[model samples]
Target: MTEFVRVLLPLAPAVPLVLALLGLLLRRPTSLLPLAALPGLAAAFVSPTGEIISLPWLLLGISFRLDPLGAVFLGFASLLWTLAGLYAYAYLGGKQGEGRFCLFWNLTLAGTSGTFVAADAATFYLSFALLSLAAYGLVVHERSKAAWRAGRVYIVLAIFGETCLLLGLLLGANAADSLLIDDVRAALAVSPWRDAAILALLMGFGLKAGLVPLHVWLPLAHSAAPVPASAVLSGVIVKAGLIGLIRFLPIDALPSWADTLLWLGLATAWSGILLGLPQRQPKAVLAYSTMSQMGLMVAVLGAGFGAGVAGTTMATALYATHHGLAKGALFLAVGVVAAGAGRAAIPLLVVVAVLGAAIAGMPFTGGALAKLAIKDSLGSGPVGLLASLSAIGTMLLMLRTLVLLVAQRPPAAVAHASAGLIGPFVATAAAALVVPWLLFPVLTGRPLAYAFASPVIWDALWPIFVAVVIASPAFLRSIAVGDIAGPVEAVLRRVGGSWTAWHPPRPAIDGPRLLTRLVKPAQSLETWLAGSAASGSALLLVAVLLGFAALI
Candidate 1:
């Protein structure tokens, strides 16, 4: 049994990875590419949790296992990748970059799916690195100027994040005296360099998670990346950092930092909403929403940490899983909304409304399931209150996104809409709606009916009502970065542009033009300089300067 599970675990990532390599030579085998994610999705369900497998010969000894925590990450990440791959195949059929897109798309899927199941620092780092680096291809796949710009920002920040992660892993593994992730985390409780290691881990993961100040990349990247790539980027890839923190941060040992993480999470949550509300495009709006949702997830982790709750890990995983499905669906729907026009778009739009509302924690939906799963850990305290408030902001952000999307006309660039394209969007929406409800009872150890009780339903509804009221003319008619980095990324391009604009020189140096106009120095001077007279004068000058300095 153990051997069978081990083989299956590695096959999850290996299948897609091999496909990615083979895709280079194949003639646009996109239809078959969607199956690459099948192994990962199967792993999420079939691979027994805690059945760890080690590859001693592979890159400093890497290992993999699927714990309860990993299952959630793997389940959602794999599901999103599968659906997005399917959508991409249909969306880009006969398009120019289909072959190139398929290659990176599978590569990214392999990395993301691997991160969840990774059991050692080496495996996690390499998987995380592959996801981070290979995604550059997806971002710049369009080869547009904007695509290139987003790719540049994504890569630059990605490199910095890699450095921080490597440092943290090195210090952590050294302290633990083991390459296994569990051992490293266990050592974090008492390691002499705990603070340094934690700081590096947070920065490295936080940057990828799109936390405030480091989040500028999300907006540009999402807006520029193709719809399928954007779906995975926002949906699954960003969660890499969150999972890293979950795996490595010794939150149980260093509970002192709980409030710190909590506040940072809240700040990120609201920052995303504030920035997203003003966005004119659905993609940009969703990008900021990703930031806010990620922040709230962090805040949940922190709150659970501070409270010393048992379910912190599970609660966070649940939240991330829910967000991944809903957000991915929303991004993919961007394509659906643009492709479906007039009356045809109405059903798709309705699905969008449900998914958006679910994001806002609407009652009896996936977001409600997420909120319910976490509320026990959060309690009815200030942090919970703040989290609830952020839901209102999310409601507004989604409402804005819906409005913007509704306004888009059918773009001619897309092939006339097909079932292949719309099917994935609908399937994702259905999965987002159905899967969690099925899992909630088992994960929370509560009756499924507990979620749908009248009071529980009301708690979810009020936020949606409040948000809608605010969106009304009376309140949110013109509704809305620690997150400053995303908005100012454009300014990075013109660094020193205005300050260094070509201004007349202030005569800081003697000009060659002035000297050139003067008659050339006599050839005699050159002749004399070649003699001992010039050499003696130069030597005397050096001697005088030395004597003068010594005297002074």
Candidate 2:
């Protein structure tokens, strides 16, 4: 690496983090949030594959590297975050809590960017922790009852995921007898506790990636967050879990594990569609769309890994990039329609149609490229056919989502597209349209001509046609967003209400008052511990314990 690139590597994540603190002091509007992410974007372009930059002075001798996979993740993620940040300005500029939102937004940006580059386990964990924890602010930025509830579920699941991840990392590192990420991943295959480590990793990263049963928090969190936050949560943040699986799982060394992931991912893919079909909220449907898309990503990962395919990382990264840009744009488009894009709502819907097609892998779009990148690994057997059928389900979901969004469009006379939303939204949409063609050849080393072949085009087109034919208003159902958690939440609420309605018979609170007075100080301590900042520290403590559990 050149001296310039070497210096630029660490600065990518560091710059935004420093600016985030400064922005907090300055109290900038939401629009300025995009400026903080600029450096990371610049680094993305110059990130040379196989380049490494070490900072021995940093926490436990951290190192950063830009391999092919890292480069793709960093570049596209930076793009999504920056655009989403600008869109946030339009969505919530000068609003109350804008400062807090900006802080956590940039902090999450730093954390995610760091995760893409870190070469050491400690650096990766810290970055992942920052990404996981700071995002809570975004989830609850509105502070409404729903937002708080979502925040609670998100933080709990986040802590759980991180705990599993931390323990897995520790086990891998201990087995490797090295702190380096590559060393630890290689050692996982040889570890005495290999099965336990892999289980921990799947539980942790699987939760973040929204794989099947672990996806309870996702739909609720996305629907509860603000538009821009939901965009990142779905598009950029989930990729953190994906990259974890790619970087650490050692798929080539353990084919059985890859097979396990294959089935798990397939289950998530189908389930997300089934559950999302019933969602009333547009964002909730998109949230489930994200879960399903993530399932596709992992499914591809498992197939490629099991096949011992070269360049699986790059191909998976390519798919991720395509999905991120398109899905992020789709979410922003929801905001535009919700804002009553006036005359533009129709035009925006046209764009949404095309975006949805891209997501469903229609011919001549980025999604097609993504599908092509992973096609060989999925093989031509039943597995491949089943995976292809997922496209039909995805298209149907998007079709329903479109119907919901159109229902939301305001009357032309009363509606007008907000100018601020258009710029970022268009940029994101354009990137999704254009970036895949640029990356596919480089990533997969395949000619673009393959994507346009008649067979390929027909294969992509049939599912979409089927989806259209099968879609009907009569079939739509709005199952409350939380899936399995829905009934559980209802039970808890019912029980709590019952307790409130039937207060236990209290003895003349004279004696109870004395008891309360004695524990008032304890209550005060409890209150202190309940604050958000304290909760975050407590999260870290839990991770440490989880790691220790692995060692034992």
Candidate 3:
């Protein structure tokens, strides 16, 4: 029975991989697309307790596992993929790039699901790399200039992140003399270069998680991808980094750099909220919100590291699971709103409001539960207060997302969204609402009474109340902070510009004036060469010498 359960771990990733390859032969949109997620969803239930399965014949000794922590990630990843795949069926129907979309979609799905199950360093790296690389195709699927530009930025950052992870993994592996993740982590506890390894891992995973300063690619990439692709990319793929932080970082032991991590996480969280405020685009606002939410998760993980509590890891994973589902559903809702109009748009907008508000820690939602789970970890320190304040920011950001989404109705001439599109959208939103409630008991071992209790409910509601009070001014309500990101982004851009100005590359110089100068010299040389018999004789001599050398 155990072996059968473990078998599903590998099979989970295998399903989508096969589908991605088969997409090449697919003549058109087919019903078979969403089935790719079934295996993973099955594995989530079958291996909730997790079992380490070895594949000695595979790669020197590749291994896969399904611990409870990994199961949380796998469950949400599978659910989001299934819903997104369903949405794509209708979303991409009659679309010009359906084939390209399906191929990349399945590829990304395989990599994301596999990342959670990888038990060894090599397998994890391979899985992470696959996810990073394959997602680019989705980012650029529209083939527009903006899409291509976003893809370029995404690939560049992804490659840098991969390099950091590879080096970190190599360093840890060398210290431990083992390829297994468990062993490497054990070795890292006492390794001489442990801090360096941690720093590298943080940089690598933080980049993927859209941590501030490394998050430039996120908004551009999320907004550029197709709606379904954006949903999963923001919701599921980014969690790869969160899981990395969970697995690699020593949550059970307090490290010297724990404070630094906590600060970094807080910065990332607040930065997202501040930057997301000005955006008019619903998708972009949501993208920044993701960055903010990820920052909070990072902060929670850092808090766990500081406290060295056993439950912190589980809490972090549960929080991530909740955020992943809700965020994914909201992105999908962005599509529904775009397709809806007049009276048909009302219910969808209401659902969107509830879901968006949930991210703000609205009462009786997954976001509220997520906050409760992490409360103990955050503790009663200044960090805790800051974390609470961050919720207000989240509320403000969600308000912007709601307004943008509501204002995005299709033209009067457009048709109502087909059932195919609305079906997945509504299904995902329902899951976001109900699934978290069902899993709360399993994840926290806490009763529904605790979740709905007066104190916890009020704690969740206050932040939202504060946000509304602040935004009550009519002008302030419409204020968007997205266009010129807050102080952090402004500072980053200034610093980057200064660095570039200080060290401009000669070979890659641009501007028509410089080009004209360089081209004029080249043109003059060309004319001189054409006019001069001596130059021609010299060229002929060089060619003759080269020909002679070749003959010899």
Candidate 4:
């Protein structure tokens, strides 16, 4: 039985991939597609921890494993994918392009499941690339101009991140002299190229993790993709990067790098909140919140790295699990609340708000337990204070989400939620609340007693109280980067028009005339600098000429 279960671990992902291939041959079977996630769900519960499955016959000796850390991530990621599958079934029903959507759906599912279990560098990168690329199909499923734009940006970054991962892997493999993840990190600790390798890994994974500037694709992709796809994207896809950082970086080996990570995480944490404050779209708000939540998770990992503690891995996973499930639920609620009416609306709104608050570390919630789990890792100092402020900002973000959700309620008579749609969300929301409590003991080795302690509860509540005290209706209004960009674009357009009006295309002159005479040299210089090779030569020539003139 033990051996059989171990074999089934890799099969979890293999099942969906097989289904995806089968989908290519047969008619689109909508009803059967969601069942593809069942194997992953089973693997999450039944796969023995610390078991490794190596396949020398496949993908150049690929390996998969289920250590406690991977299992923590695997559990929630599988759960979210499963729920998103069911939700997609209902959400995409009778819609156009169902077949194509189903294909990408299973392909993405396979990649997501495979990524969690992958134990080797090559296998992890393959799975990561697979999901990152496959999701481009999902992002562009609607084929709207916006969807295409999002897809273009997503694919560009996905390729860029993959390139980074490739370089990092090459450097890491060379340093470690092994392909296994553990061996790579072990070798990385002592390698001469450690800093370069780490920087490469950070940029590669950080792009996927939605670290700032790289994060612009997130809101665009989330808002453009379908609801169920949005849930998985926000909830599970970003966790790939989290898992990457967790697996690749040697927390015990680099304290200075860890401090660098701490500041980066802090900046990402606050940047998301500040940027999200002005966004009006519910999905966009949730997207930025995903970035904010990821920032917190990165901070946990940084703190762990700084302290050179191995146990902080579990803390990071716990925090990620909580955020993953809650954010997934919140994204799904956007669809549910929009589709629901009257009395059902209020209850749905309440449920959404509760889950959102969980992201903000509401008392008696998984978020609270997650906060408590990592308290020691963060330390009660300036970083801790900033973490607290991040929590309050999360409260504001969630509050803004709830207000937006309430505003989406239909004006018609009360209509109950579809069993198809609401069922997955409610189950996810329930898991978001219950699973953390169950896993807290196992993940952290702390007794359940510590969770319910008054001090812990109070520590969680104060952030919520502060957020509530400062929050207002006006503050909840939708704001976005476009607000600033919109005006800037207008100004640029006016300037360009003025420049064009002034210049007026030089009147087709063969030789340089009055206005064109002075501009001729500048245009020649501009054209010369525009050439890649010429630009370098031009600078050197200018330097030589200046030096010669100086000598004279």
Candidate 5:
């Protein structure tokens, strides 16, 4: 029974993907959204605990394990995917090429869920590749010039990330002589190549997670994708890299590298805030916010790595679960507003505010719990201070998001949103609020009541206060940061103008001349060598040279 559940758990996400393909082929793509989420939902509830199954003959003996960490991420990711799926149903109704979107959507879902459950290097890589590539379809669904450009940037960065991960996985497999995560981790704990492996893994997964410098594609991709795609892309897909980092990096074995990661994570956290401030589009702003939040997650993982691997897995998983749900809710709320659901606007605003607070580590939200769970690991020094500042940065970003949300209201007020849309939005918001509280005690081994204490609550509130205070002047002064890409656009246009001027088009050629021109002197020489006499002469010359050399 346990083994069956383990195998079925991995297969569960694929069911919806298959159904989506069938629906597309049958020209009944409307049903594909709900169909895509069912397997993920079932797996979340029915998969047995601590089950491990191996298939050595397939994909280098890939393994699947339903451990606590995997279960937490899988459960939340599945749940969010379901909500996004339902939201997509109504949001994309009667839209053209939605069938294609649904197909890619389901494929990405399957890959993300599979990544969480996969126990071996090969399985993880397979899932990672699938998720990354399928997401490209989502990014470029609009097929506009901007979307195309965004897609190009996304693919290039994604390929770079994959190469890094593949090399790391190879090193890991070679060191351990096993592809399973547990064995590789165990091997890394004592191996001399630990630093190299961790660095490779960080670069690969960090790119996906939108760590600094590698984060260039995230804002562009998220802003260009359709609403539902953006929701899942920002909320869920990026977390795959976080899961990879948690699973593969030998956190317990390398404190020095871990500290380095923590510092880098700090830089990432601030970089997003610094870069995000200048954006006008709400989606682009949110994209940068996602980058910032991902940086915080990286910081948490770095802290865990520094502290040793004992509790890091569970801590990172809990943090990721909270982030996945809250971020999904926030993105969905953005979609609701964008759709002109004005009557539902204020309430959604409130919900978004709460979600934003959670991202900023407001007391009693999932974010606070996540922070507390990993607080000890981060320790009290510059690292902790930097971690605390991330909360402030989040607060600033969220405040900016709120101001933009209110300012960008449609010229005409809209009626309430459909149940299909509002239902998932509300469900995710409630989960973001309540689920973390329930999970916190189990994850932190502390009383839930500790969260409400004055000191803890104050710690959470003051950072938000500071952020608000800092942002108020900027808001009042009408100091707009503007778009970062604007300057680049001017430069590109200038270069394009110069190139067009420097190169003039040639006149059309007649057929014979065109064919002759196509075959250059080098090509004619190659063709002549390929003829029978030339081939025989060339071979004879080579044979004679060999004979002369032998005789000498």
Candidate 6:
């Protein structure tokens, strides 16, 4: 029974995916969206233990492990995907190409769920690749120029991240002489390539986590994607990278690298907030906020790394799980409001504010428990100071998001919002409040009361208060970066015009300009021969002959 449940746990996410694919073939995509998360829901509740399903031919195997860490991620990721799936139904009702969106959505769900259970390098890579690539369709679903451009940027960054990860995994496997995660960690602990492996892993995963300097694509992609897609992108897809960091890196073995990770994480946390403050779009603001939140997660991991491996993993996962649910709910709220669910706006806004504060470690929320869990790891240092300030940054960003939501609300929308939209939004908001408390005691090994102590509550509140103070003048002034579209469009036009002007037109072979333009047959033939298929075959044949002759 346990074995069966284990197998089903990983396959659960795939069921929705398979149904979605079937829907595509049958030209009945909408039916698949709601059913997409059924299997995952079952898996989360079953709490299956480790079960491996090998596929030697594919050079990979699936393993479902329901350890506390994986379970925390899988539980919420599945829940969020389920809710987002339902939301997508209403959000995208009557839209053309629902089939394409559903297809990518399911594939992403499969990849995300698989990542939590994958025990080997091959399985992890395959799942990571699926999540990364399938998300491209979502990013470009609108088929608009901006969507296409955002998709392009997303693909480039994603592929780059993949390359780094592939190389890192190869190094990991080579050092370990086995692809199993436990073995890899054991091997990495004693391996000579530890530093190189760490660097590769950090770059690969950091890109996806939206770490600074490599995070340029995040805001653009999130803002451009459809609402449901944005929710999953911010909520689930980014967590895959966090999982990768937690699972792959040898946090136990390297204190120096851990410290370095602490600094890098701090940099990412600040960078996201600083850039986010200048943005105007609600989705884009959320994207930067995701980046900022992930940075804090990375910091937690880094500090945990410094303290000890086991604590770091547990604490990081706890923090990530909290962020995932809260962020997912917030993104879903963004979509609901945008779709004209404004009647419930006040309560939803309050929900958003609390989640935002919770992110900043507000008392009684999961975020505060997460902060308490990691406080020991980070210690009372400058890293702690930055961590505190990050919460403040989150508060400011959320406040900005709330203001934008209020300003952008349509007058008519204030009175009517569909129950279909409101239901999931409310459920998610409620989960955002409740689930964290349920998970906190188990993950943190601390009493719930620890989260509400005077010092802890004060610590969380003051940063938000400071941020509120800083943002008041800016908010009152209606300060904004103004429309960036005009300058960007003009630059694109100029670049296109220049390319046209610089290119010489082809002349007819028999025309007056043909003689000057045409190449000599001997030269042209030589050039063509060097690049031609026949020439390439000949070169290959010659190389083979030379090798044979040498062997003789």
Best by lDDT: 2
Candidate 4 lDDT over residue span 81-147, tens digit each: 8888888878886678887888898888889888889888999989999999999999999898568
Candidate 1 TM-score over all chains jointly: 0.86
Off by over 4 Å in 5: 1-4, 56-61, 189-193, 413-416, 473-552
Q: Write the per-residue lDDT of candidate 2 for residues 154-179, one digit (tens) a residue.
A: 78778878888999999999999987
Candidate 5 TM-score over all chains jointly:
0.85
Q: Which residue pairs clash in candidate 5? A: 56-61, 278-482
lDDT of 6 at 187: 83
Per-residue lDDT tens digits for candidate 1, residues 53-146, read 8788876777889998888788888888888888988888778877888888888888887888998888999999999999999999999856
Lowest summed lDDT over 10 consecutive residues: which window, candidate 6? 477-486
Model 2 ranges with Cα > 4 A deviation: 490-552
Residue-pair clashes per candidate, as listed? 5, 2, 6, 4, 2, 0
CA lDDT of every candidate: 0.80, 0.83, 0.79, 0.80, 0.76, 0.75
Candidate 6 achieves a global lDDT of 0.75
TM-score of each: 0.86, 0.89, 0.86, 0.86, 0.85, 0.85
Model 3 Cα lDDT, one tens digit per residue, 1-552: 866776888888888888877877877643557899888899988874646777788667767898888888898889888988888888886678787788788888888887898998998998899999999999999888568657856776788788888989999999989888888888877889888888888888988998866776788899889899999999899999999987886645645566777888899898787767877788888999999999998888788778875577788887887788888888888887787644668888888888888888898888788788889889878989999999998888778788777667777578877788889888888888887788777777888789888888988999999988886322232223222222222333344557769998466356778778856754453443342222233234433322332233
How much is the lDDT of residue 451 in candidate 5?
A: 80
Model 5 global lDDT (CA atoms, 0 to 1)? 0.76
- Give me the candidate number with maximum TM-score: 2
Cand. 4 TM to true fold: 0.86
Off-target runs (Cα >4 Å) in candidate 3 are: 1-4, 472-552
Per-residue lDDT of model 5, residues 33-129, tens digit only? 7656666566766887666766777655666777777778877887888888888888887788878888888889878878988878888899899
Query: What are the per-residue Cα lDDT tens digits for candidate 6 across 43-107?
Result: 76785555555645543445556666777788788888888777787777668988888888888
